[model samples]
Target: MKTRAITGFFFIVVMVGAMLLGAEVFLGFFTLLSAWCLFEFYGIVCSEDRKPNKFLGILTTSTLFITTACYSLGWLEAKFILLFIPVLLAIYIHALYQKRDFPFNDIGFTILGILYVGFPFYCFTRLGYITGDFNHFLPLGFMILLWTSDTGAYLAGRSLGKHKLFERISPKKTWEGFLGGIILAVLVSLCLAYYFQTIPQWQWIVTAVIIGVFGTLGDLVESMLKRSLNVKDSGNILPGHGGFLDRFDGLLIAGPLVYLFLYLAN
Candidate 1:
């Protein structure tokens, strides 16, 4: 418990600084984080007691990060879309050259993992650009809401929770705790709205609901990945936190959800 809280504070400080700095500082942080997530995924989804293609993994993973950074930095919009066209081409060529040594599922998983984690995350940076320097608070504020929700759920579950929300996928989760999380998130959001002093009441309420619900779902999604891989943690990159993915899973869903809501609602 002590370790989790201590490490959690350190992680929050680093992330908050990055988002507050904005521009290249923020982009560089995400670039490293996104790349690390790609590596972690490849490590988890290994094949039949055999090693995966390290070179290919690096290439595709870097592609995802670079394209995302470029898109975020306003260099190109469709640059990352090219990842799809080459996948088909390489799949055909590798099948012919390797004469069946080529692994279809492994290759496909690499592509899918990048798209799943990388694409949604890019939306946050895009949001940063949309709002200019002022919009920098978007992801930062959303993340705090996610943190608040998780904290509320953890405490509530330990104290008052009774019925489990999903006994199989997430045994620790409960409906009572989930509601507690939502209520806590909404209440904290009101406080943050006062601090930030720009986001309207209705939007802040919507943001709170999105973070509470999607953040929990994101936590479950990570658990599902671990359950399928038969592993407990993605990587030991963060002490008591698990991995980059572990820490940012909630933000992944919440970031894009907030981006879309603010984009369309306004």
Candidate 2:
């Protein structure tokens, strides 16, 4: 318990500090995180004797993330993104030479990793620059709301849980916990509105609700993956946190939705 708490504390400090530092630090940190998460995802999926071209998977995912970062930073043009087409096509072409069974399955999982882990993180990178200028408030606020929701849910579920939220996938989650998370996230949103004056209070509240709902769904989705794989945790990377995928599962789904919300609200 102490180890988990200590690891989580340092994780939060580093995450918050990267965001507070500026865009360069934020992009570099998350890009590395994106790569690590992609690596972890491929590792888990391939653990069942299913070979996903880890080399190409990581390469393409890293390319996608780096391209997104470069584009976001105005270091590259939109045309540069077209370079991914041939590289992706190379996946199919390379599969023809392998004598392995279910090569298509390998291809499918590889592409899915890019969609599941890579794209969402690319969206997360965009969130840091959503205002056409780099400001720490939006990304930092989002993380705070997400962390608050998770914490609230865990506390409430332990103490007041009665009904199962999703017994089949995540038996521990409860409706009581879900609502508890929403209430706390909404409260945090109100505070974010007060401090981060860029967006209105109502939008922050809406975003909090989005994070609460979609964030839980994200957790469930990752849980579903692990359940399918019959594993206890994704990996043993972060002491008690399991892996990058486990820690940022909420962010994966919530990041894209929050980006959309910000776009529409603006």
Candidates' lDDT values, in order? 0.75, 0.88
Instruction: Show where candidate 2 strays beyond 4 Å.
Output: 47-49
Worst 10 residues of 2 by lDDT: 47-56
The best candidate in terms of TM-score? 2
Model 1 earns a TM-score of 0.85
Residue-level lDDT of model 1, residues 86-147, one tens digit each, is: 64356335544543454666557656666666666667666665554436666677778888
Model 1: lDDT of residue 10: 89
Candidate 1 CA-lDDT value:
0.75
**All candidates: TM-score:** 0.85, 0.96
Model 1, residue pairs in steric clash: none
The digit string of per-residue lDDT tens for model 2 on 5-25 reads: 999999999999999897888
